[model samples]
Target chain A: MHLEEFAEGNSFIHKLDPRVKFLTVIPSVFAIAAMKTIAAPIAALIVCLILVILSRLDLKKLIIRLITVNVFIFFLWIFLPFSYPGEAFFQIGNLIATKEGLLHVLSITLKSNAIVLLTIVILGTSEVFSLSHALIHLKLPRKLVLLFFFFYRYITVMHDEYVKMKKAILIRCFKPKSNLHTYKTYAYLIGMLIIRSFERSQRIYNAMLCRGFKNNFPIISHFELKKIDIAFGIAMIIIFFSLIAVFENTFTQVPIWIYQKTLALVGQASRLS
Target chain B: MHISEGVLSPAVLIAGALLTAGGVAIGLKKMDYNKIPGVAVLSSTFFVASLIHIPVGPVSSHLILNGLVGILLGWMAFPSILVALFLQALLFQFGGLTTLGVNTLIMSAPAVIAFYLFSYLIKRGNNIITIVAGFLSGAVGVGLAGLFMGLSLLGTGEEFVNIVKLVIAAHIPVMLIEGLITAFCVVFLKRVKPEIVGA
Candidate 1:
């Protein structure tokens, strides 16, 4: 959502150096990305939840946003297993869906939710400007940095323009006649936006030239990686690797929750026997 | 479409990564410094283009315009797409961090092909045909990617066939919308600043 939400937190996670935070998020994301099973995603979810609490943000809002995306993904997961052939577990009515299908969907949902949660925690805690500065200090090329700056600068302007355009449409009592009409409306809107943005860009470029704008954009960073930040970075990496190595079984195995459900079913069968 | 890490083979990932690096290096070497402003403008066009939605049944889909990127930036589209995909993975989590290479290749290969095809049309002085070809090239590029994705999944087993079918079915409407979007954007640019497509 907004970066202002995570600003001025006293949490230890927030106090970590920007570079450490940046480095940690990337590898952590990569590790989570590598997980293929439902179990690892659920574990990652738990770990992400813990990190959210550690970061001291509004867990309620974070969760609500997370659930929104999950809801969108729910349909995707629902059809995947049925479409993806696996060892069929059982039948639902006339439909056959495999245990593997359900597990696959669950893994996708878990992985996605974890990734979103991680991003919120990182971006939420770190100041946007500070994060950009850290990116530059990390020796991300100046061009890339400038591109991001322009992207950030214009995204908001674009949003505001979209809002104004929506307001204009409302004022005009413009309602679409059908899906086709709606599309035409959208195409027209985009065309108009591009034209406007193009004209504005020209003005901006000319203004820059008049002011003697250089080929490069400038950013200033004042963050110093103190001992505490180093310790935080080391601790996080060590724990991450340890989780990867010794905990691989727990990470990659079927989820504990699912295992418990299966065991419950088995226990009932044994009693019947 | 964005490819998640777990979906791809490790070998594919490493190979895609190496190829992506090479493509970026080559793109950088040939990029014209004078065109920086124009490239920046096109990048913004791309960034905003994804925001415009086209209705496909109950769900809406957006354009990728990998073809337009190629037409505008040629081989340079590789680096441009790379940067966008990287930022997307980070900011929006659209693609996986480790699978960036695979995703880039999947999306950009079509762009490369489209660039050459459209460039041929431009030389013939057929501007409308060039624009339409650019649009169709982008749509087909995405379709090709979908087929490849399906094929990749097919290797996993029979169940993946259904998944692939659903994905392809879903993308039909998206492809159409993407084509129209690319055409409109190109035409508008053609009128407002013909120089963009003139090269």
Candidate 2:
């Protein structure tokens, strides 16, 4: 339910330094994106799934995460295969699904699933505050890190405010319809929310200043990278890149070979004719 | 709209990240230290805005009041949107970490543009004109965002024309609804707290 619910586990992933997780996950995501063939991303997805299992995450939550991600990917499938122009794999009436398009969809699905699973397995194991700290340790801008912290802290508060406002409006017999009244009411609701937040922020700022708050958000916790953390980081990098490289070499060569074979067939046919 | 990971090429990703970094640097420099809390509050509002759905015909789409944020915060929309988007990606996977740069730029750049183009009108115009300006700001914000989304997808080998058509067509209702919402909000704010408009 809570974002940090799974973060408190004693799994090896939970104990790894957040900085190492951040560093490794980012590059792995990039490597997954850079992969040109389906096999690499499939491998990446399997690896991420294994990581998720090893992290001891609940099956229900994992399934929920996958469902949310797949909803978006489902839309991609609906549009991408029909729109991408290439060798036709199938046709229905006027719509044509291209070989290239289907391949593109497959690649995107695999890569996205892998990246999403990796993020949940890696970043989900650390508290939000610790993640910000890790970002700070990684030399990210202080302002950016503070922004993340404050945004995370206040998002729920703002959402609660919106909910209360909506409840009050609904109690007034306001039903949402597609018309001017609905739009105007919704706008005022949002306007009030913003104004309230603005005033609350002023008060909060004064309170913070009174408490001797400076621009910098101080982190009381320190992170130390253990030998296993370093080893895991290195191993992740190697596994991610080598999967890409291996598949890239094999897949890239196949296309060229197919092109040459087609060329040879064309030459023989022309000579015979 | 947020672009998911693995949807863009490395070239576009790097270019987007560099551009967003530059914008964020400027935004941070321009932000007042005392105003950081206000920015944070606005960032949270932006974060929750996506959950506020508005009914438009048969289907409903969520509000993305980037124009309002832009008009109020100016260049600070960059950092505000970045924070909200980062959290969205982290919490719900609505977007992806790898595509954060492109997603942030796609949403915030139009917002900043709306700020520059409409801030004066909203601040100085008569009541009706101010409303119209706000409407245009919101509509243009969504329109340009769709345009930018289409542009970002250009390098991905999709047909440029189809991408443009699809993006714009899907967002037509969103543009209209956001325009009305923005207009009403501007009118209300003008009546109650005009100074927040930063006119």
Interface RMSD of each: 3.7, 1.7
Model 1 lDDT per residue over A1-273, tens place: 132455568887777778888887777766765566666677778878888888888767666656655654655565666765568877767677877787876766777777777766765576656676788878875555555555455655655666688689869886643265565566556656666665666677787788887866554647788998888777766755555555466453548868899999999999999
Top candidate by TM-score: 2
**TM match of model 1 to true structure:** 0.80
lDDT of 2 by residue, A130-219 (tens): 899889889988887887788788888998898899999999999998999999999998888888888989998999999999787665
Lowest summed lDDT over 10 consecutive residues: which window, candidate 2 chain A?
A: A1-10
Error of 1 at B51 (Å): 2.1
- Residue B127 in candidate 2, Cα distance off native in Å: 0.4
**Residue A150, candidate 1: C-alpha displacement in angstroms:** 2.1
- Can you tell me which runs of candidate 2 are displaced by over 4 Å? A250-273, B159-164
Interface RMSD of candidate 2, in Å, is 1.7
Candidate 2: CAPRI quality band: medium
TM-score of chain B of 2: 0.96
DockQ of 2: 0.62
